[model samples]
Target: MATQLPVINLMGPTASGKTALACELYARGNYELISVDSALVYQDMDIGTAKPTKEEQQLYPHHLIDIITPLEVYSAAEFVTDATALIDQIHARGKTPILVGGTMLYFKALLEGLSDHLPSADIHVRADIEQQAAEQGWESVYAELQRVDPQAAIKFKPSDKQRIIRALEVYRLTGEPITQLQAKQVKNQPYSYAFQNYALLPDRAELHARIELRLQKMWKIGFLNEVEFLMEKYDLNDNLPAARSVGYRQALDFLQKSDRSLKNKAVMEEKSLFATRQLAKRQYTWLRSLQQTHQFNVYLSIEQAQEDLRNLYG
Candidate 1:
């Protein structure tokens, strides 16, 4: 039997230093990076997504960034296909593939494979849900989801419009709960490598502070201008996946405001911070469910993680 190639997965919440650590590992080893972030896939979304700079890309050479425009949809199935091919190509070149990002759904799809029984996305159904959310607040939709699929409702917040919309869409299309569908057996595994999964979970308070500071830095670095440019270039709205990203959504809302006051900026910043923290909370929930994975505090245990990776691969 041939030796199975190894793949490394570095997962964490937003602003948990996964990108910096992935760059460090890329420098230290013969590793090819495949970004697992959903937001980084879109072009012209640099500042709000915290995308690696041109200099960083030249130095570390991350793959799967800037592959599509903000208007296009990139699904988990596509990620599984692309990432599997990259892993194979990297292994053929005698290099380990390092998959790094905070998108836990991508990680799950890559690792466990996706269920085949679910229905495809219905744009009309989704549009109707969005319309309902627009007329009656997202809280109303969330309450409906709770009534329809309490199991899925327990996992989502009333403010998580994207996920709430998705769950309800699934329910409306298939007349079944998404959580129940997901419980079914996976259809197939796309990759053959054994995964060495590692999660970076920093302290809660410290991570929240980092999230706020990062949002502030994004504001200083023309993040609003970037969103404005995208809005002008593409027919983007709240429904698009790119605009639905944590910081981008809040930034778009702020830009559309007729008030445009300092208070609005302050409120946008606070909302962005709160949304990021909620994202981190959801990521923590996902990370806890991952099995056979090493956990580290990226702030405090980076050196130890580096040493372990060096010893394991060397």
Candidate 2:
């Protein structure tokens, strides 16, 4: 009997060094990189998303980055479709597929296939919701979502307009609670290959320091300028998914304010840092939910992880 092809899933919270480890693995050959990040899919979103540089990409290409415009939506269902195709293509070429990112939902959707019965996004409905959000504030929409799907609403912040909009849109279109529909979804495992899943679990203090230092570096190295450029070029607002990204959202908020006096750089930095920490918290929660995955302290056990990978696939 032939062995099934191996698929590597490298997951971690933001700043957990997943990308560096993946790149090292890619450098060793026999691997093709596929990004699972939600933010990296947007074109010209390099600095805020911590996207691999153009030179880095040229050296070791990563599929699915910069595949969509900032204004467009990229759902987990879309990620599954694209990643499934990429995995097959990579396997056909006799190379192992290395899927790496912090986007837990995308990872889950790709590994455990989405429901065929779940309704696709309706643009008209989304636009209407967006309009409602614009007119009455996202708080109103979130209130409505709480009334309709309290379980789902509780999962997201009232300020999380993208998710709030999605949940509301789902309810509006199908007349069913989004949480209930999700619960009814039959688990469909799509991959023929066995996955070797690994998550980088860094010390919380170390991770927080890294996050703060990275955000400071981003601020120093034209992160705000990048957001400013996007805002000017794309007419991006808070409602857009791209603009709502952690660092970018805070930068956008800072940039939009007419009163420079009201713009406190420290406040923006603190908000971005807090938001990123919150994101890491959610990621940790997701990581805890994943079954049968190896966990490593990337800061301390990366060499051990590398050796394990070699033994698994060498």
Cα misplacement distance, residue 161 of candidate 1 (Å): 3.3
**Residue pair clashes in candidate 2:** none
Tell me the whole-model lDDT of each prediction, alpha carbons only.
0.84, 0.84
Over 1-314, each residue of candidate 2 has an lDDT whose tens digit, in order, gives: 56778888999899988898899889887999999999999999999888999999998899999999998988889998899899999999999999999999998887677776567777678879989878998878888998999899889888776788788888888899888888877574745877778888788898999898888889889998898889888998876767778888888878787443545877888899999999999898887786544333343345666786666655
lDDT of 1 by residue, 68-162 (tens): 99888888878888999899999999999999999998998888888776676666788899988889978789889999999999998787767
Q: Where does candidate 2 stray beyond 4 Å?
A: 121-143, 150-163, 261-263, 292-303, 310-314
Candidate 1: which stretches are off by over 4 Å?
120-123, 137-160, 187-190, 292-300
User: What is the TM-score of each predicted model, taking all chains together?
Assistant: 0.89, 0.88
User: Total clashes, candidate 1?
Assistant: 0
